[model samples]
Target: MLSPSLPRPLQPRANEVLPARLALSAAAAAEGIQLLTRDFAPWLAERGRANEFRVDRIPFADLDGWSFDEESGNLAHRSGRFFSVEGLHVTEEGQPYGDGPYADWHQPIIKQPEVGILGILVKEFDGVPHFLMQAKMEPGNPNLLQLSPTVQATRSNYTKVHRGADVKYIEYFVGPRRGRVIADVLQSEHGSWFYRKSNRNMVVEATGDVPLREDFCWLTLGQINELLHRDNLVNMDSRTVLSCLPHPDAGAGALLSDVQLRSWVTGERARHDVRVERVPLAGIPRWKHGESTIEHEDGRYFKVVAVSVRAGNREVTGWTQPLFEPVGLGVTAFLTREFEGVPHVLVHARVEGGFVDTIELGPTVQYTPDNYAHLGEQGRPLFLDTVLRARGDRVRYEAVHSEEGGRFLNAESRYLIVEADEADAPQDPPPGYAWVTPAQLTSLVQHGHYVNVQGRTLLACLNATAVKGA
Candidate 1:
């Protein structure tokens, strides 16, 4: 439990202006920065020399005690503690915890004893808000130190009984004077993927001069947005939190009014409907669950496999969990064009089985070739071909980046940005799709609607200057 101490108000800094040249060069990360990236090591070393920061990776074998059951496909702690697998539970009747159509399916859930806290600290600088971010390393991440939240701690790390210390800055979140809660939502992890249902995500603003750690940095919303354009620069946790930032309607540059966009979205909701039927794991067509791996008959789409992880920063140094492995690179693309001088991305209303909301906003193209081919003939996603084959001057941004390394094993995708002519874009897009401006999308992101993870990731990749000019 956090100490119930009142936070002191933040004091103003003498010179809040950023240096003309950043110590960490974004150009050095042009080839995609990660833990293993050559340039990243030097940059980190420089920061380390100047500040007190350290990151070390530990192998699962070096962890205290852990075990895996090949027969039952269960991963457990040798001491019978923390998280463990309790086999598969089949729910024929809908349960209160899960109200989705996944009834009657064999769902594998990790019995975790503690819920984690994913909180972001915010402060005002020069009347502009800035979020305190960390360059933290996770065992599963491809890059060593992707941008992470100020305080990301599981129950074990934060509680005195577990790790014997409190998570830093957690008092700002759980204790009194938690500042104005900008975004407080219980966002679920991958439902079809992770056993952990929802992690508490919160964004709070404090008005006081807080002590700075060597690994932490304060970034304006604009600067953070600029960093989003780079591949694998921002971690999934940060992107999800950024997706929840509030956007006022007064500064929008779109020709369409908020009422008009809302009306269009409402009409789209009525136009398309999604139905997900839960089938038993054993009965799933062509899928075979073996002692070690789960795969489809065609050897495509995705496979589930267990992996042991060790991280010095985490509460527990060692643990095992099943990760999702894709057959090939997935593609997520957005087609943007000027909408009365404001850039509007072609958004799709997509339905994922794991999502609480049946339909959420996604990019114009979000699919793998194998999944796209499996969508039958007519069920294929719209504008996928156009985006895939997009070439010449229309291609604005294209990069191959790894997925969330924590949950996904060796999963990556091609994130694309394409420019289209308004005249060429469809006036009457197919049901469940809309052309929403960057401002409108930002507003929707605040409400946790109109944009899904894939969409938000792509939105983060938008060039601020390019969008402003468009």
Candidate 2:
């Protein structure tokens, strides 16, 4: 073997340089080198027309290379790769926050333990940071195309399990020649739909010349921020990766200190007891497998269905897979209130059955109104009405965004940021709720499993829109 050489410096030259650069990028609102801000939507539409994309719902028997196992009744690929649809039984105990002392539910969950990469490549253009983004097509998306990250790929796709074309710009995230890692953390997905699912949310700074593809463009963070205000433009993966970017500590002060916030979250997790187990999908209760879909008896929650997808630009030109389609639109919002002139958002420590951890910080209101229609007015979630009835003047930001299109079909949530008063949401809120500054939430997002996927998306909205409480 050759003689060993000295390693490079363990610490970077500038300890806090990346955050400052990111702040500069966040402040830059103009269009970047390759794409104009106004043309982004039109360009995405053009890309949609360039491909032969089709998604037709089919029965379980028509799925190609995919089938339900005769033994377990789990819907999976024949190769035993990618993800599988399995049944989950969850029981919550010990002072559950919303419902009662105890609660339980049975649902189908997507189980994909393999960690995927959701990365955004950053390269400076003329002293300003510009991010590499892709116009990707997902069959389950309402529009079938959205602004995605530079590289969004599962282990099976990146590892060539599908025997398809290479994932573009993946080397910058994984290989030996990978760029300088600015931010990298494992972030959770929709805990309600997925079972302990997490992806590697990464942002890397490219040091060398990078080639551009037809479907990819370089955008400043501010441009992305402007685009975020639009409906279903920026995809969920891009938003989550953007949330991991470091923010400056410019807040005047927060109601809760960072240590207090962490302690509160930990307390929330410790007080709740949640037990979950995987069961065969063959005999899950309250669900029936029909010819076209597996649906709930009451027509609430979501259903699992199969689709045949054909796209020209994807790694694999054509494929068939299953998607979880929610029954109704969801409303996910954060109620913001000013404390000592500092803006703080109400964060609810929510417990979902599929979370690896017992609980994660969710938005002030995250629910599908239709699912709770049976409960009537008294049973409606707290602050949900405040979000729904807020006038235009009190609404700081509002947009309709889709969930992970790769797994969800038309799963749209009306995301909002509404101003609230002490009368609406008190200073000393009820248990399982706390007011934290956006910067504090951003700090927690740097680590894994602290905030849920919906929380991250709202945090990204605050970061992008720079919304300040009046």
Candidate 3:
């Protein structure tokens, strides 16, 4: 093994670190690690400099540099491989990707004479990059580089080739100049597959993506997709994907959304169970954004048939919780008729586990800060939310809501100082307020801001005890 300090400015590279029970490695070093780059000399030079090894730099072109690269195509782009297909073998088989027993899905491309695919035809960046097999015409393909987040035990995270979901990889077998450039794709994380062999089929390996508490794949693509969601509610955008995949409401060419909606329920009734469709936020007008909607009848109690709050992990990574949670409560009761204005169905239930998603009985009430100034010395509060709650009988409620803007003036109650569950709440807008409501053990589920004997606006915030499964 190389000395740990040898990486130097190269910032360590995640070599391989699987346990003996799950350890898998390359049999031999016939194929050195694959590095995908347009300019190999520079990359090699950098590595050589770092290693203090000066060897003869002999370079030769495989196909004699005769490529089908349409100058108008990608190799000409500002930030991508500007080369086009020189001597690639263009296949005429309009066959499916492969048979199910072995291969899963494949895209059949009609041989274009010259222009071929649009955008960067040579680049494909979808989700975090994965290991790809590289091969020349004469020699079979072999695993070149694994592209996913790597830890050098101490390196940084990164991706290669494509960026969002719709990149079209260079199909060596059939673009302009095709000569058998087929990718045996293994859908995996960066370090999962440390080796890729040429001519081998795409393999599926089981490994955990524990490196990222950071879901950059979903987060980045979600931003690129925000504009797309403005008008369409049918789908969610996807990450690392070149284009949308097959979804029910999506058109023939719709892409698979990056955000995987694990479960979709109408108040816990579990209305839709399949994956959600991703709508791109691209090109969305300023006036348009996602809004919490409800289908109400004339006189019946407004029961919730749908909700859209951000779930999973219970951790507040984004501000879309209000939009993603209630639809999750599985409410069977008719919603209060008065819930017409900016509806805020804030629940203060305890999460079953740090990993579980179920919201159970607990204590916390929904109310507006007294005059919004209760929140602080504000000239005036946004008064934009209409608070709604599900608590025991005592806590009655009211709220100052704005029907036009559609948002809440409530701040997420959090812990500044750790307090015991049996501990006392501080004097000011009392901290330690729990974020969710427990399922049973009923208590007053107050709505509307109630200025207590004191004047702090957010005094009755909720909190929890770390006592797991108590």
Candidate 4:
């Protein structure tokens, strides 16, 4: 049940018409382009006085005594052994690792001990807020050197007390100069499978002159936004943190009046009912967990598979886990059109089985049909056909990025932007949907509602062309 103190759902204002065109000013447009073209990798490498980092995988045998248990449907480590399997336990009451006297409905959780910190250091230059980002390499990323957070460290690496190695610039976060907290939230991982969580998402403003580190570069919000238009250029963690940056709608070039938009959002929020119940991993219908794979009866959605990993930068040189593998590349997109010259993207209020919130705003289509052969006319993903059949010219931005490398072994999705004609756009979108301005969406992001990870990832891709041209 929703708490009583929570604000009432917003309702649409009657007969309020939105503006047709809401274009960005000339200054904003120039800023967007500047952000897109700024080169940071070469500069960072020169500063560090080193070659760009390289990442490689280690052999499976290097992981000491790690094995999968067919009987319990869990991964295990033998005594006196240490691997990345972290903590193994049930989620009934947040208990520690052990054989569980678990309830029938209890879900298994893999609590990775490394409490990895996904921290970004922010500094001001030329009176504009600039973020300190790293051109870091991940073993699983298609482009090895995508932009990463300034300080991506696990708990073991950051805390000297743990006898782990030291993390660079760790003082900015934990020390006396931890800067202002822009965003700090404990976002959950893929909850259906791994219960791994991290405390690393933070954006702090530096007060003093902070030394620049090798492989790290300073970027403005506009630059970051421009970089998001390219595929795999920005990592998932960076996208999530970037989504948390507060974007207050100045009402500049807004298509809809704030009142009307709020009403529409509130109406959509009231239109759908989402039901979620935790079930035992062993009892989910039409699913089977084998020693090698977790699959649906139809084998169309995703699978869980074991893999070996080795990384030079991670706390451990090697480890293994059952990672979620999508059978095919999925598509996540937003359908946009100029309404009276103002651009608005179609946003879906979607529900996922594992989401912390029952329903959050999502892209127009987020799907892979591997196990979902039945998702056609009457499916939850209502307009996927329209999006998939969209013309190539309608595509404004598209890029492929691998999912979380540390968790999922290999999973990727095509993030896209498709333009629709107002004539073809839904005159009245079905229940649980809304046409929201990018500014409104950004405001929703500030409140930390409406937008989901996939939605934010795609939103991060929205560029000056889409922002100004529309």
Largest lDDT belongs to which candidate? 2
lDDT of 3 at 288: 17
Query: What are the root-mean-square deviations of the candidates from the true structure over C-alphas?
Result: 7.4, 2.5, 25.3, 9.5
- Top-down lDDT ranking: 2, 1, 4, 3
Error of 2 at 382 (Å): 1.0
The CA lDDT of each predicted structure is: 0.60, 0.88, 0.18, 0.58
By descending TM-score, how would the candidates be arranged?
A: 2, 4, 1, 3
TM-score of 4: 0.72
Least well predicted 10-residue stretch by lDDT in candidate 4? 14-23
Report the lDDT of model 3 for residue 209: 34
Deviation from native of the Cα of residue 306 in model 3, angstroms = 16
Instruction: For each candidate, give its TM-score against the true structure.
Output: 0.72, 0.95, 0.16, 0.72
Best by TM-score: 2
Q: lDDT by residue for model 4 over 388-432, one digit each (tens)?
A: 888888888877877776555456788888888655567466656
Backbone clashes for every candidate come to 10, 0, 99, 17
Which residue ranges in model 2 land beyond 4 Å of their true spot? 1-15, 99-102, 250-252, 467-470
Q: What lDDT does candidate 4 reach at residue 353?
A: 40
For candidate 2, write residues 1-470 as lDDT tens digits. 42223212213743457667676777766666677788877888888888888899988889998888898889999899999999999988655567332287888999999999999999988878899999999988999889999999999999999999999999888866677777889999999999999999998888789999988989988889988998998999999999998777654499888889999999998988888999999889899888779888999889999999999999999999999999999999999999998889999998888898899999999989878888788658889888999999999999999999999999999999999999889999999899999989988999999999999999999877672221
Task: Write down the RMSD of candidate 1 (Cα, Å).
Answer: 7.4
lDDT tens readout by residue for model 3, 1-470 = 65533321211222121111111111111222233222333442343233221111111111222222233111112232312211111111222211011111111111112211111111112312222221101000011111111110000001222232221232222223332111122111110000110111111121223121221111111122221112211010011111211111111211111121111111221221112111222221121112222212221111111112221211221111111111111111111111122111122222211101122222233222331233353322111111123233312322111110001111122111111111222112122122211111111111101111011111111111111101
